[model samples]
Target: MSEALALFASSWFFVAALLAVLSDAFLPLVPSGTLVIAATLHLSDTHTSPFLLGIGVALASFSGDLLLLKFARRGAAWAQRRLERKPGAASAAAHLLAALETKRARTIVVARFVPGGRTVLDLAVGTTDRPPRRFLRWSAVSSAVWATYIVGLGFLNEHTFDTTWLSFAVSCLAATAISAVIARVVQRQRRLARETEAVEPVTVS
Candidate 1:
């Protein structure tokens, strides 16, 4: 308990957390959300403020997203070429483009929860003809939502359960389950969109 409190109270710990969440904007498998959850759980009994941590994490993630968006916008052609070389990324980018056209904010928020979706969507948005300000507004919303959800999960679990491991385990399981469901929904939406596009007839005036 003492060690956990010491680590959570250290300034370096929050710095590392910010970096991890920031890097996760580029790396899909960084487990940034999990790190936030763990930190929240550990800091439950400490003087460290979970609300402040969540805000810091959200801002860090928002910064990373904007940075990536700028890179994608400047290197639009290069980013598109690279994404095309990867089948999964290419498919995701296509769906994200379609989704963005209709449901900008919701798509951004949903994609943030789906593994690897954020990177693809960010690149797609950057390369599109849409206004950058729109992406910026929606990205901020998604980041705040993500941070709040992860931190709240950990905080509630910690207070509800006496055993530390049990709380952590339950929180992780819940997070994973939610992630999986969102991914499945995204996949289904993409499939339906593809079929509709294929069936639609093209007309030349």
Candidate 2:
């Protein structure tokens, strides 16, 4: 993997980072962190500063996210049509859309770490009345922080970073598990709120 990234870094850093970000936006399990780490490792190995690699990764990631947001806004109707073909999927889809449309600010910020939430958040923000500059600012900052952490991990583990994909895999698993627990907690809270609303009495004229 290290060798592959080293070869890619020579001539394909931009493309690789762009695809990594796009994949990360749609597929949480894709290990985008690993890609950034690998890129930084390769750069460090070649006597190049990791900062350049980090900047490249961050820019590519931010660009990919913005593109996804644009697509989500313009293609939502088509996406809905496709999603409607699956059983029991339309209801959940509708619920997610409603949540995005109604809770753009909070949802976009919090959904940064949640699996499958990145694209949703991007789409939500794109479709809403929020300022594009604000969304871009927040998303870029978050992407930079995320890229830095992963790249820093590679730097710290430079000795065995390439040899032990297991370590990174374990970290990804841990993050996913924690995110799942958080999602469950959030869902429970939403359910409680709905229940409370359901039981509220109607006013008489």
Candidate 3:
């Protein structure tokens, strides 16, 4: 138990967490939330504070979001053109942009929880002239919320289960299930919105 605690407390584990979170910003395939939950579960019983780890994860994720946003802004036209070539991606990007136009705060925060929505929203927003400061404000909020939620899941499991591995596994599975459900809900809502928009003009005419 002492050796396990020591390993969890080591600098390498924290660094790995940061890298996972950062890479996840650009690569949706990365299971960054699971890693964060694992880290939190492992360190939950240790002297090291889970809140501190959450903060680190938040900062790292925010940095990655900022970097991607900047890059997207710089190549907005090129990115848009490429997205246009892919019908599915273009439709998703359009939905993100429309949502951003209507409810920037809600979209930003909700997208962080939705699979593949983060990158699409960032790119969609980048194509616009949205103020950098405004984006930063919402981006920070989203990152903090995501970090807190994932870390909280770990802590919840830690408190519920006697075994560390069991707690970690449960937390990860829960997170995955929640993410999948959220993604499906978001996608369904967007599709309905698109259908409504399409029918509105016809009904009006």
Candidate 4:
């Protein structure tokens, strides 16, 4: 792991950041915050500009988000069909499809902070037929904020690995918890909307 980190850090911080961002789209196992921190550390050692590193990471992350969103829009049915081919996967797939159909906006916005949820959110938004422009605008803003927070943490504590790791872990946990809360709120709002529509009186013309 250290060797991989060294190789990534040695080549170019921008490349490392780009790869990290891309990996997040499909593989949540990749620790984006860890890569950002590692890149920051390497840049600091080489006297590279931290601001540029941050920008590179932000752009790369946004690109990944955009790609996932496009895939979600164009490939959802294909993906579902493929998933359905696998025995015992139907139940999970059905639940995911339902979630994608409902609470798309909330899922996308909240999943920006969750590890695996980012790609899922993008696909959900796409499958639900949410406007691309609106989703992209919000996604860009969210990615910027998320990147800034992680990068800022690295910048502040450049020398302490223990402190940085702890901070990153806490941040991830907090983000996940917040996402759960948002999902609940969105579900409640949808239920209320349905109830309201059901109760409205119809006027005969």
Candidate 5:
């Protein structure tokens, strides 16, 4: 590895990344994306390997998924009771359930990329009785793709800019823009799904 790469490749950063991702599972406000962007910028400037960066992110994310899954498994009944008491939670759960019916793996993967979407989906998955093996299988793919694509975006921005700070600014702006777009798209899809549901006729046996 190059000197620049070696400088940031310490166990400390790897641990930090792991912890941030793990916490972000429950805390949607965590700056995991910022951390990944900063790490990628460092490697890009030094002309070193970013493969390990990708690995660190993906594994940490997977760990978070497992943690939430376990929590959901244990507290599903209690959570459901509470969710049913809250109108917002009930609506979110209904939308999540509807999405699951349309596409399970793809929904998981898409949500992983959207801001705050992962937390909702994680809780949804846990609240439902999705098998561990199936959830793991889909989560593995989602985590891997999210890490690679997001980090790759950082690399792209760095290559386009002359300074690390400049790239970081551009990348953060782009992330915000993407998140807004994703939120809008999700809202539209949910609206359409709800409308479709409302119009469907009920039949008597």
Candidate 6:
């Protein structure tokens, strides 16, 4: 196990983290965070610098997010161009654009932690008139915090467990479990809001 850590610590660990985070943006369900935690767990024993690893993860994450938004922006432009030719399409697009601009920062920050959320929010934001500069600023903060959270989890698990692999497994499982619970809570809240709207009484003029 120590020999394996030595090899990974010397090479591939950073590469794996970067690629994993990059792919996770497009593929939403990819286990990028898990990969990071596993790598951290292995390297912790090897005495690798945590700061450097965190930076790699943060930069990779930010790049992936930027790419997603750019792709979304281009796609939105194409759709708008095509839709411009159709009746009422511009009007519909305008409505969506207005809604998206309203909560650009809040959306980006909140969605950063949720699975598959950043993808949807980034795509939506890209379709709006919000400046990329604004998104980038907020994304920098989100990426840093997220990288810290994920890496810190690995350290926590490492300290708690005797076996390195056990630390990896438990960290991944705990993360998954926590995310699942958060998802359920968000889902329930949305459902209740919809139900409340459905049962609201309408006043006649």
Give the candidate number with the greatest TM-score: 1
Model 2, 107-137: lDDT tens per residue? Answer: 5455665565565566555554556786677
For model 6, residues 1-205, the per-residue Cα lDDT tens digits are 8887677665676577779898787787788998899878766456777777888888988999899778878898753454466554454334334434676565556566778766655655677767889778878888888888888899889989999889999999888887788667655655665587689698999
Structural similarity to truth (TM-score) of each candidate: 0.90, 0.66, 0.89, 0.63, 0.84, 0.78
lDDT of 2: 0.62
Cα deviation at 64, candidate 5, in Å, is 0.3
Task: Kindly list the per-residue Cα lDDT of model 3 for residues 39-105, writing each as its tens digit.
Answer: 7876734557988998999998898898878888999997687567656778888887877777989
Ranking by TM-score: 1, 3, 5, 6, 2, 4
What lDDT does each candidate get?
A: 0.85, 0.62, 0.83, 0.64, 0.79, 0.73
* Clashing residue pairs, backbone N/CA/C < 3 A, model 6: none
TM-score result, candidate 1: 0.90
Model 1, 80-130: lDDT tens digits are 987897788888898788777888889999988998888888888888877
Clashing pairs in 2: none
The residue ranges of model 1 lying beyond 4 angstroms of the native Cα positions read 1-10, 200-205
lDDT of 5 by residue, 97-174 (tens): 677777888888888877767877777777876577876888889999989976888889989999888999999888
Find the candidate with the highest lDDT and give its number: 1
- Using TM-score as the yardstick, the better of models 1 and 2 is 1
Candidates 1 and 6, the one with greater lDDT:
1
Each candidate structure's count of clashing pairs? 0, 0, 0, 0, 0, 0
Runs in model 6 deviating more than 4 A are: 1-5, 8-10, 77-106, 199-201
